[model samples]
Target: MRFSVMDLKVGDRTGSDVFNWNGLLVVSANTVLNADDIDKLQRHDIDYVDIMLRYDGKSPEEKPAAAIPQENETARTYEEAVGGIKLLFQQMLQEGKISKELVDQSFAPLANHIEQEKDVVSLLLTLNNKDDYTYQHSVQVGMISYYIAKWMGKSEEEAVFVGKAGYLHDIGKSRIDNNLLQKPGRLTADEFSQVKRHTEYGYEMIMKSQLPEPIALVALQHHERLDGSGYPNALRSQDIHPFSKIVAVADIYSAMISNRVYQQKQDLLRVLKELHQLSFGKLDAKITQVFIRHMIPNFIGKKVLLNTGESGIIIMTHPTDFFRPLIQINNQFINLSDHHELEIQEIYMR
Candidate 1:
């Protein structure tokens, strides 16, 4: 059976294959799709459906001839893990309590899910609109930290700890004034000052709870840049905690790509450009290199509409500059890196 965009709604019944649509996926009947699934569909030229479609009643017993159990397993793992994270974030925001029981219940499953699937970035991206950016940002930072630890070849225990650190990196923001948090325009100096208090607020919040001191430290130092340009405390490179450094990279990358009230969402290449520009001063050069070299390449294969109103698939990426990747438009290789006249104006993920 074929479905159109009109047939899908926020809560509608969908088949397992409902997510296979070529554009604008409507919510599945009951199953929630994640950012990874959305990214996969976009990479394959499918659009609209950003997450999994949930179905009602009994699940279909009939399976596709080409069904890959591994993919389904991975998808389910991500859904459960992300769902738990969302619940915890909401609970914390409302109740202002980090229950040890909740942490204990979710940690193993999330850790296992990460271990089973090596791609944490995809998982985080798939969770894009699962909730507000504040909550999702926390999860994304956690996932990114998990991946960074793994990429750096850290042990599983260390990786999980790092992930936990990321999960709480912005817990301080919870105490900030809502007006400041959700302001759509440029923040006044006083508003900005209020916003900056999140780090300290988060540190105090975590310290009051059962969370370890290291986790609190990570949250406190997340804003502290390598060159001592950060806030609360202008700790330099060597002074910043390693976990905090990891969270800083993840936080910045996620924030850049995320759609915000004052700032439009940036393409992967543009985000990487910003990271590369800030590498020495604001971010760690070595980690930024790894992120650009290994992480950013995955999103390049999809088709994108340039700011110039031209469209094409990303054909090649420059080693030093990601924003100038070559695009294959109408069978022509447009080398954006070498041609200063041409730049990707914007990315329209198909």
Candidate 2:
């Protein structure tokens, strides 16, 4: 079986001799690898190698199975995209500048996946990592932004632009102190004040990179709310760029549904309810409507835990009661619209 170097376990034995792109032998066959060897292989760009199957003391027909190809590929794709994002941030922090080409390269897979699949929820479900919140959040915002723009009937070029803007929106946070960013408790006023500067820092970085005017404005204005309730500038309504408005909605939605340093992830139904409330005064109502309309239906086939300690699969969505859906549990169908006492406690990913 062939496995990417990143997916190798410490006890996995090599099925073939490992070689570099230059065709020189690196490690002989049948060598047991440890953490250090796996890390070295990844650092040296030795992406994949054939691995021998576990040979228990049994008959040949009872050989241990290899990793599932589809599952491995899915895991690899996700890892590579995230690793690229992390590397991009690391490079930017070290160099004190943003690289437009590198940013494009880092975000290409996500953009391509969203463009090809046309389903943002599935992609969002794949990005549930809590350890790398910043990088994952950036990617999620970018992907959600792309879908929102596309759903709102924006041109393909315009949608892609907003997606790119979403991906790079939080680059400014890379400059903030890790202690402040990763604090497990609520930040003090002074710490929060410093945190807010990420917007200005991001704006400066994007502008300095000569990327695009809209992308720079997105970094600057994404935090600004319709009611002038946001930070850095607090420009409201017509003042905020439209692209930034799109990104703002995406950013809020992504953040609310994601696990972060200070909070656990919220249930999707609950997050949507909060977004609906925010739309009245804080977010753009039109964009919020378009987003809600497109997003709620995607939950039809998903599974959710109820507040009553029961789990079920969503079978149908109520048209007006967007949050209440009919569910199937133990061969019984329950319409949540009729069961006012019940609510979704958690959304399970596929």
Candidate 3:
């Protein structure tokens, strides 16, 4: 029976393969739909789907197993999770560790928001709060890592797990002194060294909290660069785990794009360009390229304000020009790659 996506619930099996308007198959036939699957359908504007109905003519398991909360419920999920995470960090500072249960309580709700979010470009621009830098960074990095993992073709379970690791990758920073963490100026040699140890502290804390070894490893190794320039163990390229490398990319992007007390946020596009350059030897080349490849496409359908005071809607992005795109304005299509003087100043995200 065809049912509105709004009415479909978790455990509602798809009776047929569901494809988006773009003709991309998102969910397979006979697949048991989860919150993520259902939300993806709605985001794609898929209104009616063939839901498997039992012989009695009702969808199996008439009651949904807590389908991703409706709009009213989900709007509060991210803010509430951030508040809970703030408390978790404070608790970690006091006790030196936080239990797996606590970690789950603070972060699990965000899976709904994370799964539903496709506009990451706007997400980064809008959600960042400089005052709550670390807390917000944790959430953004987790979300970014989750998307990166999925883009790299990781399974849902694996991607979510990687997201969780990214979320806690900086938990050790809670143990550091507030003065050092919030300092507005460059740290002294001694102070910088102390800050770097947060990796070990984070690893120990996560292990003590009974999270997995991989989670602890991410905390420890996320700072480890492809070269031996990073802190803690300084494990180079082949020695580092891919999960840690993934979080590292997420961490750098989040930290750089966010407004820090010491470092002002750069333009979103400029940061991606930097990431492209960093991919050479400092970061994983393949991983960084994958991020740029996927992220560049987000411009295809956005309304943007150019530095030249012109406004246009992005018609399509170019293959090699990562930030430039073909835009439509005043009935004319402008290929940004050919217009070097035109720069995107603002993305009017709705």
Best by lDDT: 3
lDDT of 3 by residue, 166-230 (tens): 99998899888989999999999999999998999999988888888999999999999888988
Best by TM-score: 3
Query: Clash pairs of candidate 3?
Result: none
Q: Score candidate 2 by lDDT.
A: 0.76
Error of 1 at 235 (Å): 1.3
Clashes of 3: 0
Runs in model 1 lying further than 4 Å from the true structure: 1-96, 116-125, 129-131, 346-350
Q: TM-scores of all models?
A: 0.73, 0.77, 0.77
Residue 175, candidate 3: alpha-carbon lDDT: 82
**1 against 3, candidate with superior lDDT:** 3
In the range 1-350, model 2's lDDT, one tens digit per residue, is 99987777765678987765534344446655654446546643688989895434354443322322233454455566677778767876887677878887777766665564423454566556546888878877888889889878887788888998998888889899988899999999999999999889888877777889889889888999999998788798989999898999999998988888789888877788888999999999999887877676556567789999999987666656777888889899999999999989888763
Q: Candidate 1, TM-score vs. the true structure?
A: 0.73
Worst 10 residues of 2 by lDDT: 62-71
| Candidate 3 segments exceeding 4 Å error | 1-74
